[model samples]
Target: MLSSVAAPSALLPGASPVPVHEASAERDRQWWRSSVIYQIYPRSFRDLHGDGIGDLPGITAEIPALAELDIDAIWLSPFYKSPQKDAGYDVADYCSVDPIFGTLEDFDALVATAKKHGIRVIVDLVPNHCSDQHALFQAALAAPENSPARDMFIFRDGTGENGENPPNNWQSHFGGPAWTRITNPDGTPGQWYLHLFDSTQPDFNWDNPAVHQEFERILRFWLDRGVGGFRVDVAHALIKKSGLPDWGGRADGASIEGFPGHEAPMFGQAGIHDIYRSWRKILEDYDGDRVLCAEATIDPLDRLTDWVRSDEMHQAFNFAYLHHPWDAGDLRSTIEASLKAFDKVGAPTTWVLSNHDVVRHVSRFGLTGGHARSGDGLGPEDNQPDHVLGQARARAASLLMLGLPGGVYLYQGEELGLPDHTALDHGHRQDPTFHRTNGERLGRDGCRVPLPWTADAPSFGFSSTGKAWLPQPEEWRGLARNLQALEPASTLSLYRTALRLRRELSLGHGSLAWWPEYDAEGVVAFLNNGVLVVMNMGTSSVELPAGELLVSSAPEAGRDGFLAPDTAVWLRLA
Candidate 1:
């Protein structure tokens, strides 16, 4: 039932993450694997208290609209109690609300609300570390010699070898050393611990038994609270090279960032799998599939399969599509490769066109005109899709991703065809990393902007207060929710139609039949069941055999609905 093809865009001669989707699992497994997932970055979603920051309450309010989109689940970014460092990725407490997001009662209500609407809630679990200000870490550091808490974290003595010799050359993902030199108010000799990301966040020593118990409790805490699953943050980094030695500085001008000046090679270390095995056992205790999607993309195709093998994770993301260049050859080969790999591993795949981590697809591909910020190498003309000739070709990408053999991940606002706004002054930017780097990193704060739900309403009805968190979608009020929803030809209307078709027909879980030449430079074709799906990438009309048209990204018949440029059409082949 699924289309299988060779791997796409290989750099190394060897194949990666072979596809291993099990044919015997319920179609729903693959459905979710292929289901459409909508990601919600809470801090920028909505403000229930008008506090200039988004909250769970705001996301709660928007659930109805998402449900209408027929989305399978909402991948909510961390809403757990945190100091807000790295925007909720740093947990201060595993079981409580951060007060700013509201109380435990509120989260419970949100979980209840989502389930009542048949929606699943997936929270961000940053088990790789905890906030330095966390009570346990404080207690451990306060009474290391005598505190049982001391064993909870990774603490050690160094030979006072001066700053030149670090315990290891571990680099922080944000900018420096994975370890920090900290002395109590007493100015004691410093101890070392791993922190793969920001210094404020420290990596948990998963090799320790205490680390296992704490994480298990954290996992069960959310599951007991009605949360369906978690998206493991840097999940692959949990294990290290073990009893590590110094990697020395690269000396090539690339000192590990954020960290003092080194790189952490703990990634994909052998010990990590044991940690995953332990975590998997804990997850299995839950009543249902407790999704454990990893933030792994180093070797996506191979990594995906490794993480989601029968004994590992239930699903992994398909970032290849996101990273691939937008052309027929790449798209065709990638999809075919993905299908083949899934088949090999008996695992499922999820397609995320956009998320809070990277540039928006529309922006990345320069699919939307009037915005030249994305680095897709397009001229001013390329941004502007030729309306009559390019609409179908453009819409084809969505159809292909949604109709593929696995899950689909959709970002909020994409349902409304919102375009990126490159209107930020240095002073207006809020991303800590972007601000720290002076614009070198895109920091994902732009796509994290506020969503435009109701046009005629105040602040697009996303918040009831003044100066909402993150900027509101500029000029969206005119093409606002109510207005676009009222007009059938509007982009919102198209989204509605597409979602409805997807949900009503159980589109995502089905097998994909990508055209034999999925890599065709001008068109991306596939057979979904009995229907033929075509997306024309060229500037001229492309013809399909005479058949009944199911849906068209553009209006009018293409000779027989010849299809327009940058648009798509689906038909039932005679």
Candidate 2:
């Protein structure tokens, strides 16, 4: 049984109201296809160490809280040994843990404890590239230009008369030339290597047999250590088009992400599918239901489905849906397109609204209050967000996303309704994109700020030492987890109830049938099994179809069956 829709309750003076949730009924083995996975950007989650940076131990300590959320799995961002150049995306060693994050023992304990709590763990795998300081990259620098170690990366001789120019006119996703010239061992000018992102993070030559073999070993090493799956970072980017041709003005004016630039030679090349097919075999060889989820930014819904066919990866992030504006028509089209495309190959569509790289959806939805951006992301320099309106929309969006028939991903602080720290100072910014663009563009640091856990604790209970790598805004105190947990009308409570009801109703694993007869112009109403999910995206209140009201995103009595604007409700169909 699930909790019923009730009026919003006043917050208790010093108590946190944790909801009681029923366990979901057991289902098929391919649970990854429809499970709700929570993503933890480890650095911003919690810091067990006084050093002010989050660690694996901090994540381990929070497993109980995570288990309370009733999420089926947890996807931890990169915690591998790194130079912090790209904030852990730049992997120095895939098999080892960064000292800052803690020892390998801590990660093992996290996996063990999470399993004990009936939660699966998915680790981030960065096989597309490695930190320039990686052992292989160092060996490449020491070996000769045409040596086998140099072949491990995308190294090529310059093309100009004096070999002074780069191999091509390729530009880095971060900014500047994608190719970086290196000095030879003899201190003479040397060949250049390619890096789609920052120069410190060199790209691997997927064409190289050694690169393929190394990633296979890396995957097996983690799987053997009890990780249930791997979330392949930049999954669509490993295999670039042959000959590295120019983008031909396809670059979207320095934007790092968007559909317009996905067609360029740098992303979604055909060969990437073959790699996933091979990886699928590795996942199958394991005893348990190990899975692979791609962080693919591929476009064309049909092409995106290719990565999730029966023999390829189990799931890929539905980025197109995430980038859709907060309009009913666009949202409906995106949802329909995603479900149709994935259904073609019998793959589950993975719905995600926010992640580590993009602007938080709460802020994105509030863009109309003068925070609009023509691109995928909005920065601190953008107009101020209407927090009240953003929170309303975010709450409604959660119900709509969770009611869909597939897997969903929840970024750490989204359940708290944390908007982007849009007032972050430029000098405190750390994302490589921000520095690479000379601060003209504020990168993703605003969304990556550490979360506030307690309203009165030091560093908002994120760390005991009251230190944080990125500062938390003063406003976060009111939105802290401890405070929200005590408020029945809080966003955190709404998420708790929604996730619990999502499982209790078996809403995650089903087919969606839209009821246009019950839907208004700006409304979306769908039926799944005996449940009807109605969302009012329009300005005015709309009449809901006759059914027993189970829950809603807003706190209001059923007034003549009217659903409030920006509200979503689940009704028990007769």
Q: What is the lDDT of residue 333 in candidate 1?
A: 75
All-Cα superposition RMSD per candidate: 6.9, 6.5
Compose the digit string of candidate 2's lDDT tens values, residues 484-540. Answer: 999998889889988988888777876677766533368877776567777788888
Q: What TM-score would every model get versus the actual structure?
A: 0.85, 0.93
Give the alpha carbon lDDT tens digit for every residue of 393-476 in model 1.
335566666655567778777666655544444455655566444555445566677777677666787777755666665566
TM-score of model 1 relative to the true fold? 0.85
Report the Cα lDDT for candidate 2.
0.83
List clashing residue pairs in candidate 2.
none
Stretches of model 2 off by over 4 angstroms after superposition: 1-27, 249-263, 369-380, 518-520, 557-560
All models: lDDT? Answer: 0.66, 0.83
Error of 1 at 543 (Å): 1.1
